[model samples]
Target chain A: MAEPNRSKDRLALSALGLFAERGFVGTSIRDIAKATGLSISNIYHHFGNKEGLLLAILKTASERLLHELQEASNQPGTPIERFKRLVQTHLQLSRGLRKEAKIFFLDEEHLSPEGYRANLKYQREILDLYREHLLALQEAGEVNFKSPTIAAFNILGVVNWHLRWYRPEGQMSFEETSREVTEFILHGISRVREP
Target chain B: MAEPNRSKDRLALSALGLFAERGFVGTSIRDIAKATGLSISNIYHHFGNKEGLLLAILKTASERLLHELQEASNQPGTPIERFKRLVQTHLQLSRGLRKEAKIFFLDEEHLSPEGYRANLKYQREILDLYREHLLALQEAGEVNFKSPTIAAFNILGVVNWHLRWYRPEGQMSFEETSREVTEFILHGISRVREP
Candidate 1:
């Protein structure tokens, strides 16, 4: 059972790397097999097809992300504290699961109808998680925003777009960059107001 | 000359629509030819091949976007006012060029090396333009942020991600949504501090 689970995990990671590099449309089962050194039949036995492999990868990634988010949500703090933890967790997870996150965006259009629905459901839950925290902050008078939905979208956008331009080897370490992002998201570019 | 230019513009628009729908990899020159009702050679006459057509479309779109940004940058206003105009300009232009914007993000990886470099240069300039405004605001003591570069990325992320979820037929009109985003970027989720 352990051997089987390890092989499946390896296959999923290998597929994710290929999908990220070549895209779902550009990657083929043969390519995945070549990358993993697994027989074509063995790959099929595991995932059924390319779409199956993608669906597995996406499902796993979403579940893991949601689990981390749940942990962040349960942390004891003010809304700002929880929000800070959420932002840090989100960025850290995103950096850690860089390839999986890339697949969630890039090859999303290729998901089968069933896969699409499942993926969208997870995505909505994630968005709703953000909105819940935001609404709590609003109620506590710690934050004011017009629409929780749109505000949530903006927050998610700030973090998600990191996958596009962030370079860990650049000027700032990921820790420093994540801290700056958390500050920007919390306070924005406006001058500090007198307390 | 007008007739040729019109034909070329029509071809680019057609290609953009197809690319957005089918993606650059899934889309074929034959599909483009069929969609545009042009023979293969005629399509070739306009753009050497599918890659050339995509390159042409991307180049034209970037140039037009930069031109609009330049106009917004030239507007008379304080940095915040100008930033508002820039945000409005970006959202409006993004709405107007929805297909182009979609193509810019979706099919960008397929660009040839030369095309990739050129596209990246234009994108960098756009980011740099945002940073300049942000830096000015920082200098004037209007805004307090650690890194102008990261702040600019956050601003752009908020708007660009609009292309993913923004719907013209949704609850808020483009004007209203753009206003909300501008406000969010200017100030963030924090409550207004008392002077």
Candidate 2:
């Protein structure tokens, strides 16, 4: 990456860390500059203000997640398979973008009004990705439910919360944890004796 | 309630609103006192400090939730019914205590260490309530999943995230939304044709 791109990346990453640790309001521009070794002017030049840095983090995180979810949803397979792939992709992204994802979940209140509106658009798109596939699966007689949107919300809920407790050094690897969580969700825990 | 009790309730409620809106670090004791119209000494006399107020809010919220979960779990019914009731109680609580629940979900990072540990004990009891019921239901062949603890977490994720987007004036009432969300979890969106 070019120097500017690298500096921007460093600045964004530092902002994510500070926002996660100290909160968006609690964290200051000087804190970000100090963390990244970038002057306050350079930081402001790249992003207009603290809110701008936050917007940048939200945009980058959501865009990357949206792209991955789209790809996973487009994969050729059963509806259940597509759902599983979406969950797996979500788990991987949550791991890779740990700080950014945490900030996204906790810092939405800090987004300016216009940024929040735009961010909601991205959020709806990601949700629609889940809802559309769920609708298809329901129509095809694969998964059974009354509301596709609620189902999508439930599905997203299961994976979005992984950022809180999912650990890299935990006993269960991400793959195993994802598989177990996905299975538990789809089939539930009741033992159904083979008919 | 006694005069002191009423004043404490007002102070704690005001603290919850401020904590949810401005965050723990952002909202000061002066702000809390101003919001409650309580003098700083009165506030301090009731709760030693800001952390005391926070701990009180957390303790009250968790106790109420834990009590409800215990009641719902102990209700005489099948495993599925108990699970549904748990979901219903969770929905109602989430609605009734919106600010406190939001703070519970988002402001844990600001809790003092002792508060966090006590809060974790309450959380564990709530989770154990879900897990034990799921285990019973699994043994009864009512629901089928691999891990009880993971299954509980999945169920929780579905309801907990409602703090983010659940709207009171939206198309669905809390009753209707809770029913749909609960149904989606139990049956999923996959349409399974009856054999």
- Among these predictions, the greatest lDDT belongs to 1
Off by over 4 Å in 1: A188-195, B5-7, B188-195
What are the per-residue Cα lDDT tens digits for candidate 1 across B1-195? 547567677778788898887788888878877887876776678787778888888888889998999898778988778877887788788888888877787766777888788878988988998888888877777464678888888888888887788888888877777776777787842334667
Can you give the DockQ of every candidate in the order shown?
Answer: 0.49, 0.41
- Model 2: what TM-score? 0.90
lDDT of 1 at B28: 81
Candidate 1 is graded, for docking, as acceptable
* Candidate 1 positional error at A5, Å: 3.7
**Model 1 global lDDT (CA atoms, 0 to 1):** 0.80
What is the total number of backbone clashes in candidate 1? 0
Encode model 2's per-residue lDDT on A80-129: one tens digit a residue: 78777877777777788888777877777667789879778878998898
What lDDT is reached at residue B69 by model 2?
75
